[model samples]
Target: SLHNSGLSGHNIKIGIMDTGFDTSHVAFARMRSENRILTTRNFLDGGNDVMGVPGGQRRHGTEVLSVIGGFDEGNLIGTAFGASFVLAKTESLTAEIQAEEDYWVAASEWMESLGVDIISSSLGYIDWYDTTQLNGHTAIITQAADIANQLGVVVVNCAGNEGGNIHWRKVVPPADGDSVIAVGAVNTDGFVSYFSSQGPTADGRIKPDFCALGEQDRVAASDNGGYGFDNGTSFAAPLLAGGIALLLEEHPLWRISDILANLKRASSITNHPNNAQGWGIPNFVNAINMEPYSPQRSLLIITPQPARDSVVFNMIFSSASTAILTVYDLSGAKVQEWDETATEPSTVIKVWDGRNRSNDKVASGIYICVFRVGDNNIRQKLAYFSR
Candidate 1:
């Protein structure tokens, strides 16, 4: 049996974009009481109140939010209940308009400025978009999603609930965006939901890059302030989004690309992803256990510290890369330098025999070891006593 990894998305910030949310539900009582909802914005009214008036139009967003951050012990626990949130009410309950897409883009930018690490959008736009425009770069929302990704935020969007509509069964905007994560729906039995959108973007890229339970998904109800059930890719998207948050919490230094790549690699159908299930359900626990992936720099671990004669430095790189390790004395003088390279995800070990750049034995004291690889510069204090 698989065991829990104890990751709860701590210190991670997620942005939820939809109609609005009801913070009065019992599932969200803990988050409300603890002040985990960092901020909110109602794009429909240009205000900060995303909760809206009582029960006016908060059902959809409320459910979506619950799937990610709602918490009620012994009842229902959301995927990333420990994560901070910034809510954006980008849709209207009365009608679906093109302006809502603009609101989505604006709200995403706002959330980015507020330092959100992930954006989970359960809303999609198709009123003004043609089937041919389902390419990754065509729609305005899709372009904005890519830009948000480039700006360092992981964008997660639903693959749309149009699978049953043969005439229009395809992923919606933003989900079709190359950089965004498009999630599809699976049932409790792990089978694809009948309504989850199918995708192979017009550009020929398989979409709904991940899958999650959406059928009869438990959520915080907006009607009577209790628990309920809902179904759609909307809920599935947030489930996966929350899982991404947990992964981010586990590997804070990992880049967005690293997170996505490893998650896909850990999915059930990594080697042969399809339109309906994409890469299949992701095993985040397995992903967390995968080798640490850092494309830009290598992780440094200096062993046998306070050395008398020699010490070993272990460096792990995610890809073919080179790194330089330099030791400096308290007076800012170079003591020794070591250079090593690796062609893949592997460790490089280097040993130093307490010598200077001129290959002569140096006086023992305290020294600083600085490891430089790509844009990462890691420094550690080392103590050396010459024999």
Candidate 2:
């Protein structure tokens, strides 16, 4: 995804409020060495050691950080690996190892003091609350989250993983905040995970702003002292936060609200947003490139580039005759050919499976597709996915 845009989150500072982080973790070593981590704070005791007190050493915070900045080439690479960080240990483990609403609010305020551009909280509070408090403005943390947004900081929270199987099936606390970028979890095929919290806050507004791959999501595992996988909306939140950092790097002059609006507009399923997936998965490639495509205005539209097996071409024609469609390899060798008779002025959609006229599969690479429609010819190039 980083290769799809020029943004690497450079010059952006992100604040992560969670359980104690493993400062020794390799995911943060390079950044720390380069002074990427501006500072560390243990909000629990107001100290500089972000590892928290004692038994509070759960590896969850380490895992969360890995999804945003961990890097090891082919082994693992985070979405915002180039961004700076300010780790805050806001969780405690004396009893159940839970972080309270007061602690969360305090962390947000502290992050604000540092003038951080983005804040990611994979932690949620529910000790004394009931399902009815899922309203957008009820929870203390939710209200604080909104205040943070008003102060020009974008807050990213995990839409609690209590969907479908739970009795109280709604997003939690800060995730319900109107301005918070509540992130939900989805499987690889884009289906909402059964455990990802459902949206449409008690006030009837969709909670999660977007969804991302979270089930069995890969991350830098503190357990292996290397790379592994963990599943939760917790993992999803940081992944999205990293994307926001990269977007900020590109549009440094824009406000957080402007960035949010553009991202919602560039969602994979932009036209239709639902409670389960909010706007849908944000296509950062489109967001950074400003490719707000409209089916009506585009002259010729080809889709699913780097497509496997098949590709589709949608073209608008005023009048037509015999349209010759040919797919060619880089060498100008004709691979796949199609001849269609268009009798009138109409829009036509064509699908092509990667193959040659001789019934042989074409090797994976860039292919030039030429559409000779009557007297006009349209040429578009596409890429095939395999090696």
TM of each candidate vs. truth:
0.77, 0.71
Top of the candidates by TM-score: 1
Write out the backbone clash pairs for model 1: none
Residue 212 displacement (Å), model 1:
0.5
lDDT per model, in order?
0.86, 0.78
List residue ranges in candidate 1 displaced over 4 A: 1-4, 293-387
Candidate 1 structure quality by residue, lDDT tens digits, 106-148:
9988887666889999989887887789988889999989977
Q: Write the per-residue lDDT of candidate 2 for residues 1-387, one digit (tens) a residue.
A: 564555668888899987778767677777778888888888777778875323426478888888898766777778898888988887765554334567778888777766678999897876666777778788888898997786567899999888865676788778998889999999989899888898788888887889988888777666556777889999999999999888778866455556778888889877888888999999887787663223222134568855787888776665655677777775568888877766776778988766678877778776667777755455555667653
Cα RMSD (Å) per model? 10.1, 17.9
Residue 52 alpha-carbon offset, candidate 1, angstroms: 1.6
